[model samples]
Target: MCRWLAYSGTPVLLENILYRPRHSLIDQSLHAKMGVETTNGDGFGVGWYGTSGTAKDTPAVVREIGPAWSNRNLREIAGHVRSHLFFAHIRASTGSAVQQTNCHPFRHGRWMWMHNGAVADFQRVRRDLVLAVDPDLFLHVEGSTDSEVMFYLALTYGLADDPPGAVARMAGLVERVGHEHGIEYPLQMTVAVTDGLRLWSFRYSSQGASRSLFYSTRVETLRSLHPDLDFLREASDDTRLIVSEPLGDLPGVWNEVPESTYGVVQPEGDAMFSFAPALPA
Candidate 1:
């Protein structure tokens, strides 16, 4: 339904990930290899943390209702802006209106969230899911897409306090409502979220199968594998990327996140853990 990528680590110009790689996010917007749809051209968005500003902890978001590859504004910004953590998404509307507000990498204060799949039969369960969002947060939701709704649901379930747990609760709630509507296996998603300092990504669905997700190999490992690559030698040890598909064909540079798993990336390193829905009472 969509494609997205999140970067955390050394501050680098956005163009490095959005446009420079062999199969960059811009390329994925037009030729996604792993997503259910090959092209995600309905809209695009980017959110990045500003290093020094009145809103340093918060992120600046730019969204447009156009293909990322052809958007001159996106190209110009990607070349100029730099951030240690950022989120990028290209959308293919499942059933929602195509508008800038509906673009992803949605922002809420200091958090940025994006998704690469859809809530199955979303319209059938939209009201219940939307009503579940806390009234305070619900007022901030500006889009009609299920992706934005899911983000607010996570925030309502405590994303600001515990990301993974909040997401599990959100997922559990969605599945509960979907089942009530007689739909089985009604969720599909690979989500990425960040709060300027740390990044969290998840891959899960009501069915055992889920969409593709991958993280870059350690910078050290890549340096050893491709000693001649200037970028590898220059990148920091903590540099990490979570993407819907591999950014390049480098044989040892990407590892698929296991089914039903989530990963946390910080300056310390990357950590993988099992993920499951924990419905809140």
Candidate 2:
């Protein structure tokens, strides 16, 4: 349904992640090899934590209702803005309107979220799912995409306090509603979320077969393996990326997120944990 990447570590120019990689998110927008679709050109967005200046606690976001590859504004911003953490997404609409608001990397305060999957038969269950969101949060749900709805659902379930648990409850709710509507495998997702300091990614589906999701190998490990690579040397030990597909074909540079698992990435290191939907009553 889309392609996305989340980066965390030493502050780097946004272009380094969005355009400078051998197979950057910009490249993926036009030539994605691993996503369900070969192109994700409907729209795109970038959300990043500013390292200096005012409002450092919240991220700054830019979204456009055009293809990332052709967006001059996107290129200019990527070349100038620097961030310690950021989320980027390019969308290929799955039955959703392709307006600017529908672009991903949705923002709320300091938190940013994006997804690369869809709710199976979303139209059939959209009403039920929308009603499930907390009324307080519902007004903030601006887009008509299942992905945005899912983000709000996670927030409604307590994302600000416990992200993993909140996401689990959100998934459980989607499956519950989907099943009630006679959908066998109601959810599909490969999600990335960040709250300025920490990044969390998840991969799971109702059928136990989710979409592709991967995380970069530790920078230190890659450094040792390829000491001659200047990029590796320039990057700090904590530099990491969670993406829908490997940015490049570099072997050992990326690891597949196991099915039904979530990962946490911080400056200390990375950790993976088993994930399952815990339906809320």
Candidate 3:
């Protein structure tokens, strides 16, 4: 129900990814090709860690309840700010109120999280999931979107220490609660979470038809494949992107993340790993 992009690589102006691409995230805010809706102008947000390692203690975040394509301040800030890890999201609210608080790439300390799909039958299972959250973490939830609730739920189940296991446990809880309410497919999501270091993305649904998710091939590989593409030339060898859809129509540059799988992108070692759903215990 939304579109988002997570970048982990060499520091570069935000606009290079948010605006310069043929179908950038800002363009997707108004012209998403694969989303359930073409226009995701409900709201938008950008979160990035600053250049100085000290700024990692305080990530720069700016969110507004306006169309990203038309936000002058967003344009100004994106053109100037530089960060190695950043997240930008354009919202298409499913059932939440349209406000800045409801925007994506929700943050907590050094960790940031965002979602592009919904927990099926959220209202039916909301109470159950909310009750499962640790009270301290529960108080941190300031919005009504299922996305934020899911983030806190992951934290409750130990996201910081073991992201994949915590997330899988959260999904298990959602499935348990949704089934109790008679919903056939209790979960649908393409989610990204990062701790200013490692990045994790998951694409899964109870029915096996998850939303679209993609990760770019290495920049060096793309350059060799399409040497004439200028965009490929500008990016660093290790530059990597995980998006709700391809940022541009560069064949061989983007690979679809298989359904029911999760991907981890680690820049320090430049490694990518895909994992299937953990077998039930």
Q: What is the C-alpha lDDT of each candidate?
A: 0.90, 0.90, 0.86
| Model 3 clash number | 0
RMSD per candidate (Å) reads 1.5, 1.6, 2.1
Q: Give the range of the ten consecutive residues with the poorest summed lDDT in model 3.
A: 272-281
Write model 2 residue lDDT over 1-281, tens digit each, in one string. Answer: 89999988878899988897788989999999988899989999999887852334888889898999999999999999988888999999998999988998899877899998899899999999999999988989898999999999999998999999999999999999999999999999999988888889999998888999999898889988878888787898888989999888777899999999999986566889999998865
Q: CA lDDT of 164 in candidate 1?
A: 95
Instruction: At residue 264, give the lDDT of candidate 1.
Output: 93
Query: How well does candidate 2 score on lDDT at residue 190?
Result: 95
Residue-wise lDDT of candidate 3 within 1-281, one digit each (tens)? Answer: 99999998888889999999999999899899999999999999999887654425556678898999999999999989988889999999998899888898899888889998898878888998899999998878988899999899889888889898888888888888888899998888889998887789998888889899999998888888999987667778878899999988867989998888887877565444554444223
- Model 3, 125: alpha-carbon shift in Å? 1.4
lDDT of model 3 at position 262: 82
